[model samples]
Target: MGKPMVLFLCTGNSARSQMAEAFLRQHAGNKYDAHSAGLNPQGVHPLTIQVMKETGIDISGHQSKSLNQYLGKTSPKWVIFGCEKAEESCPHVWPFSLQSESWNLEDPVDFTGDELEQLMKFRFVRDQIEARILDWITENRIDSETEN
Candidate 1:
């Protein structure tokens, strides 16, 4: 069987969800496939690319996509919303999803600050997403191993 799939969603696919997708791919790509989309597609943010690059993961090529891209084509094992807007906007029932959750992560785009401070905010969110992904990977490791 193929690895399980994880989809991260947010209002804009520019930051939080993007970061989560890359982190999951980096931390558990062998055990799961990580993908992300937006309720309203906004091109990946420049700061998002910069912050991720700081961690050595280049998401410069990652495109912000609409959830429609996956609605009928893919059924993720987990559908995770990175923000409250997405959680509220998405359908309550993902018929094919095994689980659904909202992370309610802070949107770095909403943070108002100088360049360095803004970058710090982006990094902060990025790190938070990474930590959560790591914990999730650990929590699911046993299940993933058994399934494989």
Candidate 2:
């Protein structure tokens, strides 16, 4: 059997979902296939690229995708919503998903501030997502090379 698929869904594929996907792939690529999409499909934010780069994960090539892309094609074992809005918008019965849940991370795109502050907000959200990914990996006992 192939690695289980994990999908991160959010209002915009711009930040939170993007971060979660990359972190999971980096931390536990051996255990799961990570993918992400958004309800609205906003293009990935510039800050999202910049922040992920800070962690040595280059998401510059990642594109924002719509939920429709996966609706009929893939079966994700786990579907995680990065924000409340996406969770609320998601259908109660997600097809082929064994588990579904929300993380409710703040949308850094919604944070208002100057350039530096805006970057900081993105970094903060990125860190939060990474931490959650690490925790989830540990809780599930996913033994990846990086965890050794």
Candidate 3:
């Protein structure tokens, strides 16, 4: 199968970016490969883990990565900015990617509410990203099965 790639970037990989990473990786599966990085690295958030666990996706091993690590380290077909902070703070020269998009999503870290409310937002964002990514994949790529 051909490699289809995507990157999710944010100020901190703890919440928004990580959730996007975990969600896309899980939902996209073999259709696309996804990764997340932060402008300034920080450990993954506990709430991020808690929220993802509800959907049976484990992100416990996902490390908060600095954008520097990915700057010249990997080639992406797509690069996505998960928050406005990442877009504004991104390096002067973006590492080349075939497709780039910014979702400008809200960071759930500042979300103050009961546990249920926060989880609901997490799930909502996760599902939204999955839908968007899958739509992009479908529109831009042809599945291996259809190549013949």
lDDT of 1 by residue, 29-127 (tens): 999989999999989999999999999999999999999898879888899999888988876637779888878999999999999999999999999
lDDT of 2 by residue, 54-145 (tens): 99999999999999998878888789999889988885637667778889999999999999999999998898899999998886664333
For residues 56-119, write the lDDT of model 3, one tens digit per residue.
9888888899888877777877788988878877734355666677888877777889988987
Q: Per-prediction RMSD in angstroms?
A: 1.0, 3.1, 2.8
Identify the superior model by TM-score, candidate 1 or candidate 2: 1
Candidate topping TM-score: 1
* Total residue pair clashes for candidate 1: 0
Ranking by lDDT: 1, 2, 3
Q: Is candidate 2 or candidate 3 better by TM-score?
A: 2
Q: Residue pairs in steric clash, candidate 1?
A: none
Separately for all candidates shown, the number of backbone clashes (residues 3 or more apart, or on different chains) is: 0, 0, 0
What's the true lDDT of residue 93 in model 3?
36
Q: After aligning candidate 3 to the native by TM-score, how far in Å is the CA of 89 from where it should be?
A: 1.7
Residue 94 of model 3: what lDDT?
58
Off by over 4 Å in 2: 93-95, 142-148
Residue 141, model 3: Cα distance from true site in angstroms: 2.9
lDDT per prediction? 0.91, 0.89, 0.76
Decide which is better by TM-score, 1 or 3.
Answer: 1
Candidate 1 residue spans exceeding 4 A from truth = none
